[model samples]
Target chain A: MIRHVAVFRFVPEFTTEHREHWMALVRALPDRIPQLRSMTVGADVLRGPASYELAIVADFDDLDGLEAYTRHPAHAEVLRISAPVKASLATVDFEIPDAS
Target chain B: MIRHVAVFRFVPEFTTEHREHWMALVRALPDRIPQLRSMTVGADVLRGPASYELAIVADFDDLDGLEAYTRHPAHAEVLRISAPVKASLATVDFEIPDAS
Candidate 1:
């Protein structure tokens, strides 16, 4: 298994209202990607001296599943809508071992 | 690799002050758990209709490494401090696929 974590840092300018709009776009992703087994989106409350503002957690069966999601058309839409509101984006991809 | 995610929800009574105390306790753990490869802690900003208040992301070399950290003396101290303020706690232990 593999988990893909995309961390985004939004500028203070976006503030409260902007996130709601971005969230709407995010909510539409799961239906678009079949390989996304689990996904969770969250905002960072402890923003003190940190560069990340939001986090997207996605669990997949393997690297290929993660790759499919990354290339899916739906993800691009999210990026397009998010382009204006976000200040920066960073990603960390790691593998998950089998339970047995 | 194995990722241990501890999701916690704190009641409104917690507010800002309580988290600072918990964070201090958290920063001290890495020093004590050599098996703890990486750790990230964040507070939820959306505050929407969710039960989670804090999310802790930890990466370990494998399951044994995770166990070592769990049994380490420092982890006990965290539980003691957290026993009071938390409303609920949930954990998901996942294995990471090897690079090779």
Candidate 2:
């Protein structure tokens, strides 16, 4: 399986409502995108000096499924909404061995 | 629960064996550290331009639990082994609300 993680650090001015707005879109994703096997969106509770405000961790069957989920319209809309508020974005897409 | 993720990009000279060497210690973590509720260590299958070579995704009951895991002797040994091979490390620690 492929694990795709994307984390976003919001602009200093972004508010809780703005974060919830993005999270709502993320929460609604599994139903909208057929390739999304599992997804979790969470806010950072331990806001240390290096903390990121929001993160999304999702799994896909393979690279193709991950690509499809990225290209979905809902994802596009999320990108559009996040453009103004995002300060930094970090992501990783990697494959894991099949469970024995 | 608190989610703690750590990703490592190894030096160009690091080999699969070095990765496995580290992973072996990681795989042995939950047994050594009672606070580590769940842990997954995997090599990156996707070698994209921005790929990180190894990653550890682990969950803890709370911030204190996460801290204890980090301070565990086995974990410290893993860190010692990784020092020579590690190129870059990126980590994120955050709290997620109860799954209702």
Candidate 3:
């Protein structure tokens, strides 16, 4: 499985409202798409320590599943909603060891 | 790779002193053990929103590597110090997608 960690930092001017909207969209993705093994996105409640305002963690069966999810129509809609407020984004992909 | 995410929560009275120790132990593991691939442990700077106090993220080649790290003398030492202040712990193992 591939783990994708995506963080979105936005202008604090719209922090609260933007966070709520982003999380809502993320929470809605798994229901709309398949191969989304697990999905979690939330605002960092801690004030200054967390540099990014929102984080989304999702697990896919493999890279193909992940790529498909990223290009899925539902995710595209989320991006559309996201474009207006995003200040910066950071992403990291890591591998998980296979038991076999 | 096997991703192990562990969250440790302690009595707030000792949070400051204890977190320093927990993170110190985690940060030290990579240098002490050969099996560790990656390790990160930090406190939740945002208050009230995050339930866990400290989260330790480590990725190992497989479960055997993970077990070796856990049973390794260095980790055992950390646990010995951790016992006095620990309140609760949560762990999850997930797979990362293989690009191949």
Local accuracy by lDDT, each model: 0.67, 0.79, 0.67
Worst 10 residues of 2 chain B by lDDT: B44-53
- Model 2 fnat? 0.32
Docking quality category of candidate 1 according to DockQ thresholds? incorrect
Clashing pairs in 2: none
Displacement of residue B8 (Cα, Å) in model 3 is 1.3
Per residue, candidate 2 scores C-alpha lDDT tens digits across A30-49 of: 99999998887878776765
User: After best superposition, candidate 1 residue A58: deviation in angstroms?
Assistant: 5.3
Tens digits of lDDT, candidate 1, A12-64: 78876777677656655777789988776656543334325666677789878
Cα lDDT of model 2 by residue, B1-100, tens digit? 8888766778878788877877878888999999998887788776665566777778899999999987889889988988887777666786666681
Pick the DockQ winner.
2
The C-alpha TM-scores of every prediction are 0.51, 0.86, 0.51
lDDT of 1 at B75: 85
**What TM-score does prediction 3 earn?**
0.51
| Decreasing TM-score order of the candidates | 2, 1, 3
Higher TM-score: candidate 2 or 3?
Answer: 2
Who is ahead in lDDT, 1 or 2?
A: 2
lDDT of 2 at B85: 76
Q: Residue-wise lDDT of candidate 3 within A1-100, one digit each (tens)?
A: 5666655667667667766776778887888989887776655432343345566667778878888997999999988877677786645454454431
* DockQ per candidate, 2 decimals: 0.04, 0.46, 0.05
- Candidate 2 chain A lDDT trough over 10 residues, lowest sum: A91-100
